[model samples]
Target: MRPTVHDIAAAAGVSLATVDRVLNQRPGVRRITREKVETAIREIGYVRDVAAANLAKGRTYPLVFILPASDNSFMHGLHAEIREAMIRSPSERTSIRTVEVAAFDPAALVTALEKLADERPAGIALVATDAPEVVAAVDRLVADGIPVVTLVSDLTGSRRHHYAGVDNIAAGRTAARLLGRFLGDAKGEVAVLAGSMLVRDHRERLEGFAALMAQEFPKLSILPVLEGRDDPELAHMLVADVLSKHERVIGVYSLGAGNRGLVRALKARASSRPLTVVAHELTVHTRAALIDGTIDAILNQNAGHEVRSAIRVLKAKADGLAVIDAQERIRLDIFLKDNLP
Candidate 1:
């Protein structure tokens, strides 16, 4: 039989009220008393059933998710996952609020975060922009005892509790290696498309791609990175213009969203031999392009998994519990034409 609070109190030679205070992490218990209760708990191997305890206390975590307001499939999918979680809120006992700010706007993101902080939610999960203002806001939240998790894109030099995203630099390196292998010994230029430099994910991917290209494939020249802002029309126009300007371009690496624009541009050049195209995210457009041999490879991060992981981490931090590191680690998924799921 498992030991109960009664056993813990008796073993610690403490009153039932003191045992409750220590167990629930309530204040007023002295350090020595708390240690005594903790020692007793360990001796009896008292494993807390968090689910049962939450149910008993009727505790519901209030969490906020801040996302970019871009018309990208990946963002839509993330919002969908958050909605799905809200549907299961009854059992999970979580109230989620989503706020969408202008994409790639550091000032706007900072303002949104400040407003959310005003409400003082239990936790906040956001796709952070790499800016001093944003970092300061995150640090403020941490100082105020509100746990914050950086999702998808991370903010450096901030007091964020956790980051629920893939290793973006590694993802970029993988994309570069795949492109190099696919276009072996090709003497042509490669065009890189990204959302914005403010985003850490896009910057890290560009860094990795540039590093690998310089080191492994020095023969191939890379064009200036075009900022599409993750907008479909912007990406399409930029890609078309770059293709026209650089006639020898034989490879394209899109390390951000806006594949719809890329698809249109590549399809327009159907008469020419297909370029070795690589992109991020396995969206509807990219998936179709892969099947039709338009995109050679895709490096993807599951936005659904990222959103859910952020929720779990925020909840665990709010409750002052240790999270299962392996469970919270998000993996980068690679997809090919043959494996279209």
Candidate 2:
């Protein structure tokens, strides 16, 4: 049988109230008394019943998530996930709030973080752009004992506690291998479209794609990366410009969002040319495009899974509990026309 708090208190020669105070880190306990209670806890192998403790304390985890205000399908999906969480929040004792800021704006994100810090939420989650100011802001939040989890995109060398997202570098390598195999030894240019280099995910994807292309598909040349800021109109204009300049473009890879614009450009330029198109995310537009042969392959990250994982981590941290690492892993989902889910 597991040892109870009364058993630990008796063993430590301390009162039940003292044991409770020491275990919960509450005030009015001497350092020596705390050390004695801790030693007794370890000796008796006392594990706090987290659910019972939470019930007794009536704890409600307050969390904030910051997302980009881009009109892209990926951001929309993320927002939908947050809405779903909000729906289920009441029963879970979790209070979650979302803040949207301009995409790729580090100053605005920092300001949002500062505002969240002022409010003193128990935890924060954000889709981070790689910026020193944003990293510092997150570090400050951490220093103040608030758990910060990076969602979708990560900030390197930051004090963020956890990252709930797929491995973008591996996703890019997979895309490259798929594209290379689909275009069997075809010596043509592949047009690349990205959201922004400031985002670590996009930059990592570009690196992985370039590395694979140099190593395996030396016959194919990757054109200069077109930055669309994850905007559909900008992506369409960039694809059109690239197609007009390079008639030998046999493939296109969109490492970020904006598949709506990609599909538009592809349908407009379909002149008996078998171009292999690969993109990220499985949105309504991308799904339709895949079925109609506008897109050949899609490398996707489940937005719902990412958001859920972020919330779970935040709640666990707020309760000062260890999370199940395996359960919190975000996986990359590959989709094709035949296997669309």
Candidate 3:
């Protein structure tokens, strides 16, 4: 049988109220008394029943998730996942709300974070742009005791408690391996399209791709990175420009969202030259492109898994409970035309 508060109080020679105060970090307990209670708790291995505690406190963690307002299909998918989570939230004893802001706008994101912080929700989940002001805002929220988790993209130097996303470096390595092996000893220039260098995920993906190309596929040369800002129209224009300039380009890797533009660009240029394309995210456009031989492979991160992981971690942190590491792990999902889910 597990020991109760009464047993801990008796063992520490303290009143029940004193033990309660100490355990909950409430006021009115002396340091010595608190230490004695803690010692007793340690000796007895007393673990607080989080469910019971929350129930007693009538706590239902209100979580706020801030997502990018980009028209990219991937962001749309993430929004859908969050909506699904909201539908299932009641069963999990929590409530969730979302705020959408323009992508790649650090000032706008910071302003949104500030507003959310003012509301003082139990937790916050956001896709962070690698900006100093954004990081400072997240730090301020952490300092105020709000649990913040970075989703999709991370703020590495910030006080965000956890990042609920894939190791984009590994994802890039996987993409390179797939592209290199599929192309087999074929050598030609490879064009790289990225969302923006300001995003940590995009930067990491570029780094991994560069490392793999330099070490393993020295035969293939990487062209200057094209910034699409995860915009379909921008991606299309950039891809068209690259294709026009480099007729010898054999492959393309899009390490960002907005593959619709990529597909359009590839289809337009397919008649003149067949370029093997590898992109991130398995959206409808990319999936159809893969089926029609426009795209060779896709490196995807499950948005549903990311959203669920963030919610779980935020809830645990808000309740001061340790998170289950394995359960919170985000995995890279590989997709080929043959198998896509």
Candidate 4:
């Protein structure tokens, strides 16, 4: 049986109130009494159940989710999942809120983080813009004893307590393998679409995808990445221009959001030529694109699962408890035209 405060009190020959004060670091306990309680705790090995105690006391964790205010299907879906979590906040003993910043703007993200550092919520989850300043801000929050989790897009070098996102580099490498195999020894220029190089996830995906392509599929040359800024209209314009200019392009890798733009562009320039397409995120746009033969494959990570994992990890970190690493790992999901789900 696990030792409790009662056991510690009994071992220390002290009252329950004195043990509670020592455990919670509350005042009014003398130095010697605190030392005796500490000695008893060390001897009995009493482990406090933070969650259970918080529940017993009706403690509410105030958590904030920081997201980019982008007009894309995936971002919309992620926001929706956060809202659903908020709906269940009362039962979960949490107070959840969201803060939207400009997409791909490091200064705005830094400002938001600075403001949050002042408020000092119980925990924070953010879709990080991977800039140096943003990393510094996250480090400051961690130094201030605030537990932070990166959601969807992670800042790897920062002192974030956890990442509630998929292995993006692996996802990119998988996309390359799938795209290369789908094309099957065909030699042509491949067009890649991305949101921005500012975010760590996009940069890592592009890096992994490019590395694998160069190593395994040397025949298919990748064109310069088109930064569509995750804007549907911008993506549409960029893709259409590329298709019109690069006649040798035979494969497309939509490695970021704004697939609707890519889809519209591809459909407008549909031809008999074998142009294989692989994308990220299983959204309404990508689903329809896959069904209509515009997208051949999709690599997805569950937004709902990511949100829940972030919450769990943040809560555990705030309580100074170790989380089960396996339980928090976000798995990648692959969807093809034949296995649409």
Candidate 5:
């Protein structure tokens, strides 16, 4: 196989971004670093022909990011990362526009997707809501020759060009293992909190978590999943009610945002024994919960990395270039109190 930019970066002992800057002849690289990249390119026999590639795709791309309009900390962080990407857009020769719709509202998401389809942006990166209408809209975009990538959450049966997120099933199984081990021989019940079942990621997570729990930890009972819609107040109320109703509940696997509410409910509960909580995403609330012994483990997908990966994938698809799958894969991060960053 021909050496790609990744090979050049590895050979030069530099970052992928730096390699891009050097290859694109963008500013801000030190003379030594530029020389090292060039030397690596020559040694690896990596023929970039960036001028030809640029000439092939002469138009600047206008990409759109459709994120959920939620007050959740994770959503805020995702938006912050997208803003950072916007800041770096000039160097990438792309302009970004962001649209926000209500979280867990499938109709709203479908409407937003339809609106973007009419505009026909070069590429679209979306945090998808699993709905038939949304999927149809994605099909329309794909048919129109527009690159569509799902960010964070995925939509099945859609012609999306790529999914720039973690393997959520693995994430769920990992969460279940952490919670099960944390519980040890103790047997009770595990309550699950999710954002919405409409999202493929959340559904896949619950499936993996339940399957593992049934397979490995047979003694532990899993309660029906409660949807919090990624809302803190709703999550707090649902969690509080579940805790109140089930005295034997010993663990919680939160597969979505609304951790602020989960933490609040746990704190307000009048129980002598604490529940083993394994939750998704590392946010301010989840981190504090982990530190204070309210949450056991945090399964995290780095928002910045996901956003950056989506942008990279979309740009590559827009330019009719192949993306390095290994380089674009987003990692699932597991954080404990000791390993918090």
Candidate 6:
């Protein structure tokens, strides 16, 4: 049989009450008695299950998820995952709260972090707006001994404990390769559309895409990136205008959200120019677009998996425990028209 507190008392020549006092570090137990119980536990290889102990003691970690108040499909999906985690929070011993700030506003994000620091929750996770002030705020929280994790978009050069997102640079390079190979030497100007350059993921994706395109596909020229602010209307306006003017633009790459606008613009293009389009995130619109042969390929990351990872890492950090790196690594997913999931 597995050794229990009774075994420790029997081996240490102590009463059951004395064993409990020693194991729980109660004040009544003497140092010598504690040492004897400890020795007995070591000899018997007693292992305490932390989850069960926390449950028995009614210990809960209060966690906060700071998100952007955007109308993006991916953000909605992320919110859904957090809600799912909250549903399981009773059994998981977690109390989760969500805070939304204006998207792409660094000052708002810093203000939120400072307020959260004052509240002093056990852990905080955010969709970081990559900026100097935001990094400073994150570092301040870390210095205050708070476990901070960056979710989705990350803050560059921040002291955040973990990032629960995919390798955006690799995702971007992959998008470039897919678009380039799809074009197959029929090179022309490739127009780029983006939500914003304020987030690390979008910037990293653009960096990778441009670098690989310049190094390998020199024949295909890249146009200036159109900032759509991830708004469907804005994206549609920009893409539709670009399509009307640039007759030679044969390929398009959307490295951020606002794909709904992109799809609408592509469908409404005045010219029947064949454009090989590549985008990110697997959503209802993106799925339909891919199936209908509008977007050539999509690179995606599981938002639900990222949210779960952030919570796991946060709990581990709060308890001063090490997390398995393999379990925490967020992987990239590639999808094509032939394979949609």
TM-score of each: 0.92, 0.94, 0.91, 0.97, 0.84, 0.90
lDDT of 2 by residue, 1-341 (tens): 99999999899999999999987789999999899999999999999888678867778888888999999998999999999999998787888889999999999999999988889998999999999999999999999999999998889799898999998889889999999999997999999999999999999999999999889999999999999999999999998889888988999999999778888999988875779999999999999999999999999898899989998898888777998999998888888999987
The total number of steric clashes, by the backbone 3 Å criterion, in model 4 comes to 0
Per-residue alpha-carbon lDDT of model 4 for 1-341, expressed as tens digits? Answer: 99988899899999999999998889999999999999999998888898998899899999999999999999999999999999999998899999999999999999999999999999999999998999999999999999999998999899999999988889889999999999988899999999999998999899999999999999999999999999999999999999999999999999899898999999989874668999999998899889988889999999999999999998888888899999988999999889876
Best by TM-score: 4
Tens-place lDDT per residue, model 6, 179-247, is 889988886999999989998898999999999999889999999999888888999999999999999
Report the C-alpha lDDT of model 5 over 1-341, residue by residue, as the tens digit: 98998999999999999998998789999999999999999999998765356755565779999999998999999989988988887777778989999887889988888888788888999999998888998998899999999999999799999999999899899998999899999989999999999899999999899999999999899999999999999999999999999999999999999999999999887365678889989887888888988888999998999988888888788777888999889999999999987
Better of 2 and 5 by TM-score: 2
Residue 260, candidate 2: C-alpha displacement in angstroms: 0.6
Question: What Cα-based lDDT does every candidate model obtain?
Answer: 0.91, 0.92, 0.91, 0.93, 0.90, 0.90
- Candidate 3 lands at a TM-score of 0.91
How well does candidate 1 match the true structure in TM-score terms?
A: 0.92
Which ten-residue region of model 5 has the weakest summed lDDT?
Answer: 50-59
> Any runs in candidate 4 off by more than 4 Å, and if so which?
none
**Model 2: CA > 4 A from native:** 12-18, 25-39
Q: Which stretch of 10 consecutive residues in model 4 shows the poorest summed lDDT?
A: 266-275
Residue 71, candidate 4: alpha-carbon lDDT: 98
| Number of backbone collisions per candidate | 0, 0, 0, 0, 0, 0
The residue pairs in collision within model 4 are: none
Q: What is the lDDT of residue 225 in candidate 6?
A: 93
Residue 125 shift from truth in candidate 4, angstroms: 0.9
Error of 5 at 288 (Å): 1.0
- Location of the lowest summed lDDT over 10 successive residues in candidate 1: 46-55
User: In order, what is each prediction's RMSD in angstroms?
Assistant: 2.8, 2.0, 2.6, 1.2, 9.7, 2.4
